[model samples]
Target: MPDPSTLTPVDRSGGVRMADVSQKSDSARTAVAFGRIHLGEEAFQRVRDHDINKGDVLTTAQIAGIMGAKETSKLIPLCHDVMINGVEVDFTFNEEKEAIDIRAFTKSFGVTGVEMEALTAVSVAALTIYDMCKSVTKDIRIGDVHLRAKTGGQSGNWKSEVSAEEPAQN
Candidate 1:
């Protein structure tokens, strides 16, 4: 293994450094992240049937996902703050597992990838689901959170190795 010192710091001056976006041209960037909250059948039915006392769980979660994306930098240290062009949150019901699948897509025209933002959105949204459904299903477990894809920047484009079992969705 190589010595850790062999790798140069982002800034040789040893001072805190933001990415050097000055030289890079602005380009459209996007990222997708996935997450799931496994719920008991009773809780799933409440969400599926719009019977939750808090109203629509899916809608609430979707909005939470977007807000989470915007507040990513605040939630995760070391993440850069960037203007978000757009964010989309999709929710799907899995009858077999009695769970809610969450996918967050975020876009921006900036120097940094939205990977953290995408992931944060799904995580917060999953937590929101648990908060809303805890009354009926205290055992709900958040699971399978991962990035699906990202695009733009100097590296061009990138797509995550998402499995066929949970294909990327709109």
Candidate 2:
């Protein structure tokens, strides 16, 4: 993934303005992102057993994530309103880490890429898990958020060499 610092700020060139993609032809684009939420033993079990008082943690989080991806344009200013063709949010239980592993995939055919949407999906999914499981434990920690891969854009295809499954201690 490109360093966030390397990305052009909205106001970096001249005055603030949305980048023009009008001349760029629409193309199939997709982005995948990953995130994790660490939970205490009790909380993890409650989630796995669907014993949370807030209801099915994974299902609820999945839905919230898709919705979040759809709302990415509104959440982040300057993002072109790309029509998302599909969105998927899947979760895995990492027993060793005692964490819920989140993966989000977003698809779109547009001049702009759907990287932000994919990222937003993972973020909202992690946040949803934290929200629904907060009552059981407050130590819930969300981290290791990063884009795994992206395709179809002027920048071309790319994948991160670093694994996003583990959160950095810092």
Model 1 reaches what TM-score against the true structure? Answer: 0.87
Question: What would the TM-scores of all predictions be?
Answer: 0.87, 0.89
**lDDT of each structure?**
0.85, 0.88
lDDT of 2 by residue, 1-170 (tens): 65544455444444555777788888999999988899979999999998999899999999999999999989998888989999999988889989988989999998999999999999999999999999999999998888988999898898887645453221
The clash number for model 2 is 0
Q: For residues 1-170, could you state the per-residue lDDT of candidate 1 as single tens digits? A: 54534433235545444454567777899999998889989999999999898878888988998999999989876578979999999888888788888999999998777888899899989999898999986989998998888899888777777676674674
Give lDDT for model 2. Answer: 0.88
